[model samples]
Target: MPYVAVSALSHNGLIRSHNEDSLVIGPWTLCSTETESPQTLLFPLGTPLVVAVADGLGGHPSGDVASALVVRRLARIGPLLDSEEAVRDALTACNEAMYASADDDPDLIMMGTTVAGVVMLPRAVLTFNVGDSRVFDATRDGLRQTSVDDSPPPAPGHRTTSLVTQTIGGTVEFTAVHPHVTSAPLAPESRYLVCSDGLTDPVTDDEIGEVLRVHDDGKAAFELWKAAMDAGGPDNITLALVRVSE
Candidate 1:
């Protein structure tokens, strides 16, 4: 049997009054099933799976709502879909839903969120993103980030590196969709980390690796949050760690 240890924390940070960041684990089960079904499966087709994430959107009206919406949408993919086309279609559906919610609610105007999530398959590791959030692969060698930022076109053609150009419900129209999706073979004894920019921006990448190196899931999570707090936690920090064991 494969076991996934999930540890997560959300902080208001030093500057923000409210936490705009959110982390999700097993949300697929939570969102998919209802009163009729007591047991919900996130990936019905996979044997060993770990899908999770962290989200951070610029604190705007209903940022929290937007984050939750994206996480829930991604979580409920009934069975694993191997093709990129299927995943892209799922993202498009999420965008439409988010846009509709924002348009319907006056308070949720301009609501948006950054997402970083992972999909574990039988033979490969799939990580994807829509903003500045990131997914990192942690192995005995070291840690490596998988996704790139999808910021706006830098100068009509080029794209910005650090800004968040595409996210859930950021635009009035349902267009301007930019997704950073990629897949790679899963490494043996490999661990994965998905987090919001809050954790990456305040805490150095080296520090993050060290924390993961020294502790298990719970301890690593606490240490990460502590480091961000020590650095004045300018933004809400969220982290999820997944270790694949044989």
Candidate 2:
């Protein structure tokens, strides 16, 4: 059976006073202040595994709490997800949970987060995202973005465009979440990058592909962080690199 080697990490970045990003690998969850050493785990061909990154809305209050809540909710549903519908349901549940939490508390009003994740199965991988966080598929041909950003299209010649059109708990009202979900056949020796905007905002797609090609899974993740920091890590950085092999 094929297995997956994963290297996941989260950093507070250079400017943030607090880390508002969260990550999930299978059942384990890590917040901005926490870190996970690189590790590899073998899963049977048909086993279901989940890997995700959540970025709290930096402009909103309690953004970290919202991000943490999103991942924690997903962790519970991760094991149960087996199909595209299941993935949508899981994300919807997360959205509801965030809204409910915020409704019950005055301080948590307007808390929101962007979520990007993948559910890897034996024969296929399902990718999903809400907001501007993204997932990318890296292969011999090139790097392709798999998840679509839920933000307005940038105007021509407009360089500064970083506004998300939708997100979990983005508004105080109860709004249905529309997560971008897609699936593709699983292939051996394939690599996938799931990350928050912190990394994408600083590093380019070419840079990401170069790092993945030159370094192993573990080092690739670290180099990505370095690339973002070297470019002035202005936001929280979080990412997971998953490689599939027989």
Backbone atom clashes (below 3 Å) for every candidate: 2, 1
Per-candidate RMSD vs. true structure?
6.2, 1.6
Q: lDDT scores for all predictions?
A: 0.66, 0.85
Which pairs in model 1 have colliding backbones?
151-165, 154-158
1-246: candidate 2 lDDT, tens digit per residue: 678777888888788888899988777788667453444545554567888999999889899899999888877777788889999988988999898998899899899999998999888899999999999997777789999989887779764368899899878778899888988998878789999988988888889989987888888888898898898998998989887888
Candidate 1 TM-score, true structure as reference: 0.82
Candidate 1 deviates by what RMSD? 6.2
By TM-score, the best candidate is 2
Model 2 regions lying over 4 Å from their true place: 34-45, 158-160
For candidate 1, the lDDT comes to 0.66
Q: Which has the greatest lDDT?
A: 2
**Model 2 — TM-score against the truth?**
0.94
lDDT of 1 by residue, 1-246 (tens): 444444555666678767666555554422211111112122232443435443635746677778778777666661444655666676678778887887788777778777777767666777877788888887767778887866544566432234666776776566656667787886655578887777787788898989888977667777887888798887777676766555
For residue 233, give model 1's deviation from the true position in Å.
0.9
